[model samples]
Target: MKKLLYFEQDSSRIRPIVVALSKHFEVSVAGDLLELAATLRQKEPRILLFGLASLPGAFSIHILDRIKQIMLNLHEEKLASRSALSVVVMHGDDSRWQQICEPYIAALREIPFCDIYVIPAATNPDELAVSIINIKRANRHLRTARMSATAEVPIIGNSTKMRHVIEQIRTYADKHHPVLIVGETGTGKELAARALHFWGKRSHHHFVALNCATIPETLFESEMFGTERGAYTDASTRMGAIEQADNGTLFLDEIGSLSLASQPRLLRVLETGEYRRLGDPHPHSAQFRLVSASCINPIDLAAKNKFRSDLVYRIADLVIEIPPLRHRAEDIPLLAAHFCSHFSKDAFSLEQNALDKLCAYHWPGNVRELRSVIARACANNSTGRIFADDIQFLYQWKFEGNSQPEVSA
Candidate 1:
């Protein structure tokens, strides 16, 4: 079982956590910062859960600074070697806790800490426990990705429509204005944006891409603007994504999915090119180009009150529509040859008849689907010549009236 520590001034505030965490781990509850620091030094914990409601009314900046120092020192000492020990700062609302622990919260966001999650003060113990489990699972996935070094993303495409995308990428490779890429799900919207950034003048700098739809709404501001030391309950000091992309390019994919509540904050950042870190009074300018992509049509969403029109107008300065693969049938063979060479790296040549058949299919999934099919065929075929069977596998289930088909790639 893992060892877990909880730090909170009020024992009552941590009662639920102690009971819940004890079900799976050896949990210790601490009443004050000094006690918690001493306990941590004596017995290292796999995870640390902070209870923000226990902060005293007279908690001063000096005390908060000391707590942050303790956290940093503890983390460094524990992480001297590879270990699962991680810190989690849980705060209730945007109250005095924000001002008190801003530094700790900032630090947690960037390094040392695993995650900084915010919950409503009224959240039940069961829900909080589930949240912790989910956070751990997410961090595990992050670790895996870091280790693997090659996790294929969902973006796929191959038709002439995609060639037009490549063309647009080439065209915008030198421009400084923001480019808005619009497409449907699995349409390679992000891939196209990244291609532009990589082939652009800012290619040497960072190409920070974020999915606005997936980030928790409560973290949107902090993730984008960064936070100062001791700004909030768990904050220490960390730079936001925009700050990280200061000299490069920032790609905001799935921009349409951002919560309506958080849209205005993003708009403010775009309008002024200036933003204040969480708990910090001074605003900082992050000089970087913006590239945003959306599957949903912002115009339609705005008319329906689903998205902010003002942000749409500001970001859509250079709108580039990536056509679906069905319309660009001419590029099918070209993309197939490309994928065949890429995945097989052999002298693989597609039979003209098989190539023609691939061009006839109406690909609803666009270039992404074609790439998958090509990759599968290349991986399975031993002979250099790809035949009809290679391309036919994608539609085998449909002909056999089966719900599932074997996927090779």
Candidate 2:
């Protein structure tokens, strides 16, 4: 188990935090600064917690100077390198404590430590845990030279268009910018979004997805901003998807369908990192990365005033456009084989005739249509191997005049 060494003058407050963190870590308690420092040297704990009062007696410049000297001297010690150390300072009731701690805190900040958090005496343990974890993760990421996670695009195809898309995905996977995926309906927009999220820094947090088109217009506010108890006809206190996805990625799909009235509310949250729950006077906020996708051309919709231009700008920080299946014809065989294997109970191989038929067909419904066709063909075939006759009828489907000539079975 992970180790935590906590030093707090208030034994009452420490009990709750210790209980909560102990579920995931091995926790130890220290009542005073001297004991805490000795425990630190011996145990080398992962995290350290201290109350503002724990900074040794006598609140004078001399005392502050002594603390600074000790911290500076410790920075020179090679023994401090092994563990990820974080210090949390819980301010006491004395107003004078802040004045004396400010300069010392600034000096401590310059020293190389994982992180330093200042929280109210009344702060909840869950919020404390969230802040600690985020800082821990941020520190780990900064220390690494390359991405700690190897993000790979699972789809395979040799087509020029497919190759370009994969390259673009690789380029944007590790970036911090918001990503907007654009494509025709059923073009695997969600797949692209998940690939980016899993490859990015926020992968450890929840990947909460909300479909704007799927939600009703009346409930959009409640769904996005949780309601407070006694706020509305049937309101109950709850956390919204935004808070649930705090420090993680929130995937908003078909965002164009969101009402214009709801757009400004979303814009406010993105701008200020704050939002008032429905019927709640106080505003709560969280740090969440946004990833949105739309099937329609967002630019065209914004021009027509059907979609908010401001919202579009916020969500489209880094846009990725996915080509329709008809445009990336070479990918048809690859996608077909993937889906056939997905639908078959046992290992199944696609005949060359079926692949030729798939390439010849005009994919009106894009990737979704291909998946459906492959599923139907796999379920109907009694044999494990798929034959040309199984998928030959796809060539007879009506194609746009610009479509490539049909390849014969």
Give stretches of model 1 more than 4 Å off: 1-168, 392-409
> Native-vs-model 2 lDDT?
0.70
* Residues 297-343, model 1: lDDT tens digits: 88999999999989888888888887767676776787788888888
lDDT of 2 by residue, 1-409 (tens): 7677877666767788887777766888887556766776777777766654434324434544554565555557755765436665565455466555666665654555434544334356754555455445544653351244345536566789778877777788767678898999988888787777676655545467899998887787778876665688866555567755665678899998888888888889998877776776655555677889888877888999999898888888888888888998988878887887789878689888778878887887888888887887888788888877777345455666999645353
lDDT of 2 at 193: 76
lDDT of each: 0.70, 0.70
Query: Against the correct fold, how does model 1 do in TM-score?
Result: 0.58
Clash count for each candidate, listed in order shown? 28, 0
**Candidate 2 regions with alpha-carbon error over 4 angstroms:** 1-153, 229-236, 392-409
lDDT of 2 at 215: 82
All candidates: TM-score: 0.58, 0.66
Provide the lDDT at 31 for model 2.
72
